[model samples]
Target: MSLTIAVTGMNARADNPGPGLAVARCLKESALAPRVIGFGYEALDPALYHRGFVDRGYLLPYPSHGEDALLARLTELHEREHFDVLIPCLDAEMQSFARLAPTLTGMGIRTFIPNSHQLALRSKDRLPELAAATGISSPRTQAVYQANFFHTCEAQGWRYPLMVKGLFYDAKLAYNADEAVAIFHRIAGEWGVPILAQSWILGEEINLAGVGDGLGGLAGAVMMKKRALTDKGKGWAGISIHDDELLFAAKRFCEVTKWRGGLELEMLRDEQGNLHLIEINPRFPAWIYLSAGVGCNLPDLLVRLALGEQLLPTPPTPAGVLFIRYAEEAIVSLADFENITVLGETLRFGALA
Candidate 1:
């Protein structure tokens, strides 16, 4: 009940909210009721000012700044806050945190995260291989570095109306090479990667949020079907569903990967009832707090795991739970902005150090 934990991905923008705010909200409801520290890259990340969810906020250098700078900033924050655990909620930052796990532990920061290899096995570029290993169907995917690849890809049996993707975010359906080239450059420019060209599948979307105990055991699983979507195709409203087939696929995925921590499996079900693996996200989705609402508190369970506690199998969450995304303003003082922007940190109850 006395643990202080830090969580990242605080940018709770309406169009594309991050998961940290939801994770913090879930933690606040736990019996432990730990002190929540919001860790963010941008100073104005809305969760920083959402005092109801976050007790304090600290600005950290972006993941692109490399581990040294990130470690230095975290070390300083730890010196002042003495947080007991950290739950990173952004996909792009997971690699850096996974690689720095041991170093963070050495500095008395406990984090339960999959290793880099576990993360890599389920990355977008490696989805095909993951499908093969788990005996699941996956759309053909090719990782491309240059737009020119689009010009010659059809020769390799790639078809039109393909999905153009970035390493971290952004997905567009390109009906022709020109569209493919445009999207390729746009995603590459923003996310910086070998752009992905994946065969587009026609189907309804299904999602599963599952927590792994780092030993090929699934702590809990919740399946949902989207009832509404944002313009960008993110789930805007969804309802929990009980699908044994989908749960089997998710269980197999965790078993095959020995995946640790929370992950979301995005899948598509074709008209003929064939299920295809779409994408594997390493961290919890922005809708994660829905797990808490459904009687499975994954973030709190993750904290217990990070603290070396053994876990019992989580019961199946009751189906029919629904969530609709909405927006609200977080009132903040000019002083709160100045402290985080200029000093890179701020305390809500009172100034600390």
Candidate 2:
């Protein structure tokens, strides 16, 4: 019970905290009983982290305040209660965690992340270019920071039906130059930065999740196609997709990044049968828990890696296993309806104990 296991960036209301909870639960179930420390704007379900995996819980206003500040408290806590590992599931925390890894090592915390330059390449409008150079295909795109470059993209044959994507948030689709300029101003006013423009290809959305060894080796891989996505368009609500093409692109992307941690690859297929890289999430996405149920156990495997163990090749994680978002509907005021849509499965794991 002396070892501490921290799963940061969790909220009590979070429907799927995925890696944070999955790894915490695995460590606890395995009798590690490491203290689980969670940080976020809101409190987490104490029953999950504090009462179970966590022995002590503290809340922070936000992670931006300080990274090591929490660690300092952990150091204080370690004087009274020791910790063995720190697992970060938040996007904001990954780069900072990686930057501080050396210091954390000296302070007795085990963690992982890509270097800053690489991390920057993974973020914002620069991602697609990096992907293309590494033999991965990205959408027909242009990132415009200067006002004059908008016309440059048009001159290069990027025309109507293009997307003006917010660097930190949403993407506004404009079918013409006028609309594109208006959307650009709106986005620039709010975000105060350049926006990424790309041809809007309406096709199936796919995500490839996996882990890599810092070197060119892979630990595990799982593929998911969107069955449903939230209307506003950040992630999928339900997904239905799987293919070797997906896996190869994911493997190649991870290999190219030299990424060492959980990664979620966002991609799209055009009408010509080309796979285009969209985005790369270096942490667990919301649906990652579904992978565990299907037999991947990425979170558990990731924890073992943090403990400095050499990773084994990932076993077949249900190649055909599928996911559906369970939703409640009201047929009428008198009765409610629940829907469960089963998709497919390569192999299924036993229910969590």
Candidate 3:
């Protein structure tokens, strides 16, 4: 019998999923061809998401907007569905999965994740610290809590044009020491805690995605650039170009971390052209399909690894492969804007092929 797997993710709502959609699609096309279930609040259309692949998709209730309701639901689902592999995605889910690994294993489901301590380093505040430890050039970074910490940042001579960020996600950038401190204090006051601080890099933004063996080895990988960013400043509205330097750097970074599962490294090529480390997203990235276009099918590799299969060794990939996201609108007056006809079609072919 084929390995039956279940991919866990939130459904799309006002917050359209960037890479999550791609991740689900990849799983749908895999050798096992596992069922994809997006567990979320009543915001996502499971039917639409499952249109092509899932044997049957489901929607589960959460305890409010938070995922505190997960452990029980996941436990119940595992018992009922009898899925061989369970992949919980998103930072929130990653956190829960790390905590629930032992429990899930006891319940007969295999999970992929890092320990909680390692996961913290993937958090926004600690990402740069991990980079520095790995000998990767990260933006100059610090964590500050109150006004005092902000004042110290300025007095200590932190570089100007800095990024002040949340522990879970990105925040705003502040120019000059004073402005940065003020923003920090304002944000901190609102939250009652410190946010992350980092020197901004003025250069090309590149992101690499891959999967790991969890035993200190690579499984699958791909590298791509941020050709064009969406309005939310999330990921590629369009992308083209791939680089080996990026692939190498990404692989080496994961090796250094001893990362055991899916990973995405967001790095910047600074003015001097150094690939300075940004953050490590140990989850599927927004444009992972772009990576598949070049031969690194992360989701497939993830499934096989989860199934305990041997992997084919991958050599350093070449540069110059290109992909661009196209959007379709009306040439003349029309009520319908068919994006599927433009960007989605080519991306789907490139991703599946």
Candidate 3 lDDT, 112-202, residue by residue in tens: 7676766776677776677767677787766776655655665777766788876555467777667776777677665546677888889
Of models 1 and 2, which has the larger TM-score?
Answer: 1
Best by TM-score: 1
What are the per-residue Cα lDDT tens digits for candidate 2 across 1-353? 35567676544233333345544554565534455654444432322233444444444335567876755655664454355677677665677677777877787877755667667767757766777667877776667876555656667887678888776556777877777878888888877667788778877777877776677656777787766555556444544355788788766766777778778888888777788787777777657666666677666666677788876687666545666544322121111101111111000111121
Task: At residue 119, give the lDDT of candidate 2.
Answer: 74
Clash number for each model: 0, 13, 1
Sorted by TM-score, highest first, which candidate order results? 1, 3, 2
lDDT, candidate 2, equals 0.62
Candidate 1 per-residue lDDT, tens place, 106-219, comes to 988999899999999999999999999999999999899989989999899998989999989989999999999999988988999799999999998899987888888877
Clashing pairs in 1: none
Q: In model 1, where do residues sit more than 4 Å from their true spots?
A: 350-353
CA lDDT scores, all candidates in order: 0.90, 0.62, 0.63
Model 3 stretches with alpha carbons more than 4 Å out: 11-18, 45-50, 53-55, 59-68, 147-152, 176-193, 238-242, 315-353
TM-score of each: 0.97, 0.76, 0.80
